[model samples]
Target: MYKIYKFDEIKNELVKLHEIDPNFIDDKNGDYFCIKDEDEIIGYALVKKIENNYLLERMFVKEGLRYKSNGTKILKFVVNHGRGKRINKIICNNKDIENFLKKYGFKECNGHLELDNIQCVNQRVTEGKKVVMSSIIQNIFLAILKITGGIFGSSRALISDGVNSLSDVGSSIAIYLGIYFSNQPADEEHPYGHEKIESIIGNMMGLFLLITAFELVKGSVMLLISGKFEATPSYITILWAAISMVVKFFMYRYKMRVGIETDNSALIADAKDSKSDVYSSGGVIIGILLSIWISPVFDIIVSIIVGILIFKEGVSIILETSNIILDKQDDEFIEKIENYIEKNTPVKNVHDVYMRKSGDKIFLSLHIRVPKDMTVYNAHNLADGIRESLILDFENIKDVMIHVDYLID
Candidate 1:
């Protein structure tokens, strides 16, 4: 397998290519593209911008590598890289490359082959952002309904659940903002992009929920100890609780699906939080029923229990997000990647395969040992192949950085 990249620095192995073939041009005026086979520079292509169009100055494949499809690979890579250019013109003496350029959509225009009228368009908004916005809207609606209903019906459990929903509005807002910022392109200050902001928001929401849960529980406990229970909750509270349960159930399913699909940690946490809301609403209904049939004290007891559940959820979120923030090594994920690299590539040994989660993406860095006699260019190409394959195979993998180590025999 071969990998292609934009060539910048003129390294020793690149110089070796000229030594191997005296005709090889080492022009630095235009953009140089190098195609590597197991780390050796086996082929190259050059493109230069003149006026408003791009000129395909030269394309070549090493003598022995020509008939093996290396030429086609280089042509495809170069064409894709110049897609948005207004006009792509080719100037090549090789008949094979000329045929390839034509087959790849370049047509004879006057004396040179040209591919013209390439169009560039803006990308659509991500699914993660859309889903998070939906969450924020739903939570806001639910918080308003539950708070209004609880206050009018005089149900402590319903009021506490309302506050839970209110807190969810805050959590959903955090998630929305996280997804928004994470989608921004990488800038100088944040080379890795703003993906980690999602994890940080997750942690902050957990802490917020923790504090909210404590206050709710404290309020319920004081009411119980003071022996000043409010009137039995009206039938309206039961209807409101039922409505909340139904809404939260659907919200949970929707968020979980989108979260898994987008691989967004904040969205997943928000989904689980929705699930907790359903359970709390169920408790609210039961407390309302028992208070009407048996005793109003059950209403206060249920609120305390609901508060405990919220606290438990808050702790869970904190632990999960903390692991992601601290770059906790996922042994299973690392093992799977290492196994794939060793089995599918010429890597002699895989080492230090580390990964960290940020928003919906995972960034991986690893070290792999290659043959001691392999040139640095060969090692670099081998690593590039492994990195490309890993990223293509794993959807969540956003980037991979590899270090080449010589196998000590």
Candidate 2:
């Protein structure tokens, strides 16, 4: 991983490029950042205040890493560094560099590249769609494998697990759609964005899983009551069951990583479901082995157990999504915000810190007391700084609104 930090040392290369006076290297008026890969500084960018806004004066990547995404990383760091502020211009004549900046929400005006605040599409939407589609494909393949094996080997447990995988395909598609629509940027009609769509999809998937579980249990129970011992489960059923466990375990890990990175509730719920499938398959394997050795009744019991597990996981997902839909306040998140403000700012008191979630996005509001003699402009600036710090320091915070009050003398 590449790390970016303020550049303190004057390097010979940068001195030649920017004609820096050694004294100017540590100037407080401008911000200088160097990109370090381990201990080696591979790139640097300079952003200086030009009147009210910022100007990207010079940005460079080492010749060896010029076309290898190092420049892109540096540019992203510079953009994020000034996120709540302004980056008015970037001096880049290279067509490749210009195209790269354009992709990251920059546009050329009078031959000067400037930040364009409006984004037509979000990158998370694309990543979420890709992960969800991968889940759908994997589930479909597993469903076919287990269903065919169960039919040929006379294992009701394997068949029940296959049906669960089939249901997951439907749920994955629903999650894909939710990720796509929920990421649509906020508009006039919908001021808060469409993030709640993810919670709604999560609820629907939970209900679907409940219905699927009921059917699985019903089928297994009917077979058990009929006293039907068709035949001993074959070795092929156990083999297929083992394969399902491995596959589901890996899928769970992959989806969980992406879900956490994107903070998508629907994807995370789907990952948890995948995890349950692994345990369910493990039970199927044990039941198949026992049926081959002793009696076929074990297969029926295992199927019922798998259904119960699915129902339990479904209830968990529903409860998780319900909290988001109900706009429950996250006490831990609020406490963190209060602690941050108290420790970092000059506020005499910080109170009323609150946070709520909309899908993966967080909205925060708080009140703070500043010195009574502070100028109105300085107070407004302080509030803006606080908002900016919170948004940058914390992940997924969409906005922060702070109410400033005069402190008691």
Candidate 3:
């Protein structure tokens, strides 16, 4: 089993960080984080909270994972973690990493980007047009944190957990946009309403889920091929895993509440995804801990499980949303509709009932038989009455197209 760098090994790096920013570590009183495998230390990060601002003193990943998404993930975690602390600005002097920071909505001011107004941005994203933006930020942050920890700690299981987060982030934008567009009111061109756009967007998210599943398997394969195990994953990673699990669970609850309040199925799906992440992170923690006492192979097994989960979820989402897109018939729901219509309205003998979805909104088309001798004028009036009855009875039923036809004796 591999091991992390011991205290003596990390001292040299700490000295360098001190030189770069003396305020970063107070020697007797300061904060810094180290990353390591079971064998040796692989990376370290240092930061200082200065009043309303944060200063990133130094961050480094092992040469093997350096310059890869592994390193980027760690850097992203640091940035978001700082933002989460309500830091008005984050200042970093490392010119080499400037480009990475800029890509994540950070802008250079003078020599560095001040992590200022991060709280403002987060507030706006949560409250305004970008209601789902907070989920994106969380996904990216937790994904990188786990991946960086996994890389240095040499825990394949943790990496898999991170990969799961990547899947969510990949699907989040499409899902968010779907919710946003579905909220639009019915117009001249789309009289039935814009809710269908949500269903289409949901279908697109299914594709994203599949793509991310593929990514999870690919990463797992690469790890297995290397056959390098860092046996003694650092305590830091365990701490990170625990923290991420708690945070992810809370996010699931938050999103679920929003979903219920707004009655948006797309958002509810997103919440379920977040809830799964909470458990996945829990799995990562269990794997790493078991590796210490049991056969280190537990990590690999966990990695495989995570991939399977990603694949299963992707297929399920694709099948569900695709059915709506393809207009698959739902006999059970049709029965419910028929029962409701007969009970509430004068119309009888419901037939040709059809249902499909657009976003969370359900559209129904059906024909009902009235008295064969009923007049055309009466039939038209009865159709209007049926549409009104269904609309009032079911909350999600947006519009009903009823074709009046003669009752067969």
Against the true structure, whose TM-score is highest?
2
Whole-model lDDT, model 3: 0.68
Q: Give lDDT tens digits, candidate 2, residues 1-31.
A: 2232334433434564343223234444556
Model 2 TM-score is 0.76
lDDT of 1 by residue, 1-409 (tens): 3344444554455667776556666666776666665546777777776776767777877887778877676665555545535444444434546777777777776767776654333122267667767777877787788889988888999999999998998888888788777778789988888888888888998998999999999999999999998588888899999999999999999889888877777788888889999999999999999998888999999999999999999999999988989988889999999888866676758998889887767899999887889998767767777775576567678789998888888
From the highest lDDT down, the ranking of the candidates is 2, 1, 3
TM-score of each: 0.74, 0.76, 0.62
What global local distance difference test value does model 2 have? 0.80
1 or 2, greater by lDDT: 2
For each candidate in the order shown, give its overall lDDT on alpha carbons.
0.79, 0.80, 0.68
Clash count of each predicted structure: 2, 0, 18
Off by over 4 Å in 3: 1-131, 185-191, 260-263
